[model samples]
Target: MSDSFPLQKLQNITTPFYYYDMELLERTLKTVSEEAQKHGFVVHYAIKSNANPRVLEMIRSFGLGVDCVSGFEVQRALDAGFKASGIVFAGVGKADWEIELGLDNDIACFNVESVPELEIINDLAAQRGKTANVAIRINPNVNAKTHHYITTGLKENKFGINQWDLEKVTDALNKMKNIKLEGIHFHIGSQITDLSSFQDLCVRVNEIHEWFVSQHLAPRVINVGGGLGIDYEDPDQNPIPDFEGYFKVFKEGLNLRGDQEVHFELGRSITGQAGSLITKVLYIKEGVKTKFAIVDGGMTELIRPALYQAYHKIENLSSAAPEEKYDVVGPICESSDSFGKAVSLPRTSRGDLVAVRSAGAYGEVMASQYNLRNIPASAYSDQL
Candidate 1:
């Protein structure tokens, strides 16, 4: 058994549940806080990643704000004891109630994506008799070099306002009395491992900043959204991301005015390595070539693999025997409900505990009731 997990204790609990290393989470938060504070940058935990109450509480304790994509997330953050002043709402489609909720709480800013969204927010804020603070989310046209589904900064993506449309947005902003232009926002993509992608973002941001200044609408907050990835290939070797280097890229690259605040909406990098999916091998079926280690967990618990063809390290924690290749699969009825193909693990048998590593971020939050499977429970290391 791996020393990282308490196998003896885990065996007693239910199978196919999320296990979080709170200590590792705290350490990750501490490092992010310290590094962000060094450059006077604001780091907001992207709540869409993992909204676990305990996880949110620990993040709140570290003094990081939240980046919410919806009103429910904003409410969740508020319920988790995060201050309204520290919350920033950003999404392409913000419903009327969602916008009103942000306005009701006086959220820090709304990263408005298009002119229509800006107008809707203005109208809603007018009805509420409040001026809504907003940051224009600009499509920087920079490639994040990540998965095509996640790359949002490109002009072809439906995320942010194109550069040509900024003139129209500014014109609309000038006429809207209930809207306050607080800043500008940009999110290239998620799970961006290439640091040069961020550097490219910096260049585009600087150009856009100059254009806004020329129009006499200099933004106070420069929200260059986050996509720093974690080491899924070797979680134990590098549990904590290189936050120092990640922050330095922005610190050195962004041409920020003295009064401007730099903000990041980091999701995966913060919590990805701190959690894992623990399941028990239910059956070991011999296929034509390799054996199949079918576990109880499926796409209902963690869908990244089936959805994005994403990779997560699979380990057999209940055995220390000779290594062998086995196709790790889940119990979902769909044929695509697989974890990893040809996964190398110890000589495994039925009832052997298996772990899917680096699942803290999008793992539990994106779970579904597909196949009528019960939502997996979560366990924290400190409590165990």
Candidate 2:
């Protein structure tokens, strides 16, 4: 393995582990905070993307809230120094005990996903004798323009309450009197890089907010959920996400009320660019078309390529020779356990260190123990 890859001296460490560039994470956090503050928006670190402890600490220091999806995530955020008052919990199916946990911790709010869910929360809160601050996760039925698996705000998606249920839903909330309607949350999709898609989201949010006002149930918080993507292709060139452009779209387009508080749920953009999967080339076998650069770390280490058919530009760290094409793959037995086919790289060979770039989000956290392989370990720059 290498130490502080591409810059620091290489150390003889284990082959498979996650390596993070702390400097990149800090830079991203600062940019997200600075740009979001300009428009009175508060960003919550969506821990679901990558809950690496080292990454969470840096994100917590940025004075950002935590966007958690489970009771354990809520506790993880609190344990990581994210203020309880700044934590927001969201999920399609929140157990009653999870609701109780949120109430006990006094979490900021909950992204209520359905009519039945709203009723369940109200019932749970009434039992505990507390008001649960909530944000109705509305499915705006907008195309997120991303992968089908990650697209969340569509009509067919199993997320948020639909348009036809709003009137009846709001009426139910009014009758319950245990759940507080503090905000309306909208998360269209993830890995969305197009700025125009967000502009469309803003337009839809405004329309939904107006519809709520017509019902005389206007919310105080407007959480346009986070989906700002990173430049995964050229990881070194555009390491940080487009924070300035992302925020500007909302600032210039969305109409906000005087007392309304804006919120964002960012996960990948903050931590994705800062991490990479380090592996060692086990063998290089010639094929009919492209050569196979077999690495020790397989889809078990990073599943984005296998799951989303995603691309992560790989680097032959020890190679400085002229480039050649090869199919970078893992030692896993599965047919889908491949990094990239026909991937162009410098002449690679056994014992060469291969650094899979731009794997910070949806990478290590999604790793598995399939084939009874040992789970990967993590190494940080400061620690090394």
Candidate 3:
């Protein structure tokens, strides 16, 4: 499946819409399954990344499980035809209603982040006459070597339970009757390109595993939550991430028990390259230092650039003119709405088609009606 967009077809559709390459998506899923199955690792698609119905349904059809961070996502996964037994819930601030929803659905496990959350899930499960399977989310303090905002496993970050509080967590687990201890979960951060960080995590988990055995506890699962990164600079050159190498890291690093199953909650690596934000050039404004290619899509359409200063390769599909430097920006009022500063693209003009590559994961899912702008529509390769 080619990542290139059809400018003629895109011209007929509305501007600032998502264009998904379903063929690419399918191939990516197949690769992920092949690699994960090689090591007998189970993968759960993180719904927080992209909950588009079509995307979710395709993932479900691949026989992958769902990893939800909220009650609504759990319902979304269910509505998309993912089985309740294959769904796993993980969040730091799960509301009471969310816990009830999970209990009613009998989700595979809830990755408990704190003692209070563990207690609440237990209470909710008891009220429902069900036992909630839970995995304690541990803060291993391992650096993911990525952006600070997305780094989650550090002790200072408000994500997993700190190492110092393991004793309290175990004690709370012993007292929480309605909850069944299932495993240990860790998600250090997002968009992690460094493999060494995962190796560090494996070492930490081995140490933590010994601690659990010392306490006479053996878990049935070991969930090393996913943070695999994708190449944003050259999506076509490296459309699919190095799944073989990625799974190999865990195969070699992690210490697994005979009865335990290893699981991963992958998001971006699976979907990032399969979607692009197709926007039309609204105007061309001459600036002091650089020309501005003003696009209809803004922070509202794709917020990753404005939110995390994330990079997405920008292309001008309508022109084959000599390469020219431009500051690709959106119509939003905020200064941070710029997609790429000093982006080199073909000399562009009004109504030129521009494609923002590598937006499948957090693009449409995180879009908003900010500025009262109508939410952008989506187009798929199959449909177009």
Candidate 4:
């Protein structure tokens, strides 16, 4: 976060684009790896969050595994140099062909979400004459208390196999000789800031582990899926998440068997705050009761503001005199393509750089060419 970098760089580059702080990203990765190593837990970066090749390579330098939600993500992870033994393929509706791809690649594990998905993998493994290792993704009905769209552990969400179906799921696994139930996985949700939610998740995991033990199936692994959140309000203040508290929640709450391995699938907390959507203000339209600081970047560049109504702590980087209230908006044709309403800034002016912070996760990866708008090109700080 050099004082001169953003403002000076903004003057030379196009108005709207993604600007990455590689130094920040490297620091974040170091912090995560160090914390995760303390508990002897295996961390798999969720590639679905942000698959930028540069970001992937930087993260891969940390020697972390990858957690993939799609066949493309699996392929991307491998293409990014992640080993086959380090990829965990997880998705609710994995196609049969994708199962074959995993089997062909011999990925580390498949986080099967349903009995049918497990059966499909079993059937596929039999064709390939291989034993497929899997962990049943259980919806423990735990609430992450985050945004509704990101909340996945709820009963109604089409994320994991519910408790009521566990018996049938376990029975299906037992009947299938080729699919080995290596462990049980739980992913509550994403962008979860509350540490208490993780504690609750661990408690639930312990109870589920106990239940599995009662059924003569104590798994040697307990994967508490990652949703630890980074600070959007104050990114620099909280560069790293409370990894000590997050991992410790599982330590105090989960009942682990001897020689058991633990795992996590953290995504946002690792990269979200390290990047920003830099867009120059095109027009500062003043209204009777409100002001709109229109910028070139719209929902096309970063959809979190429109899709999730999410906050990113926008800042007028080029202004330093005083702050004023204005609605930071985008150039998209849709009325919904807005970043912030009544947002206060440093009394912004046209051509001033407006940075939408904490955008590394779903920013560039989710960019679109809607309304025939050119998808914003990206520029990393190191590249500059």
Alpha-carbon lDDT, every model: 0.93, 0.88, 0.92, 0.87
Q: Residue-wise lDDT of candidate 1 within 1-384, one digit each (tens)?
A: 447899988998898899999999999999999999999999999999999999999999999999999989999999999999999999989999999999999999999998999999999999989999999999999989988988889999889999999889999999999999999999999998889999999999999999999999989999999999999899999999999999999999999887899999998999999999999999999988989999999888999999999999999998999999998999999998999999989999999999999999899999999878888899999998
After superposition, the stretches of candidate 3 with alpha carbons farther than 4 Å from their true spots are 1-3
> Which candidate tops lDDT?
1
Task: Summarize candidate 3's per-residue lDDT along 276-338 as a digit string, tens digits.
Answer: 999999999998888999999989999998989999999998898999999999999899999
Estimate the overall C-alpha local distance difference test score of candidate 1.
0.93
Q: Model 4: which residue pairs collide?
A: none
**Candidate 1: TM-score?**
0.99
What TM-score against the true fold does each predicted structure earn? 0.99, 0.97, 0.98, 0.97
| Cα lDDT for residue 271, candidate 1 | 94
* lDDT at position 92, candidate 2: 98
**Residue 42, model 1, lDDT:** 97
Could you tell me how far off, in angstroms, the CA of residue 52 lies in candidate 1 after the best superposition? Answer: 0.5
- Candidate order (lDDT): 1, 3, 2, 4
Per-residue lDDT for 133 in model 3? Answer: 97
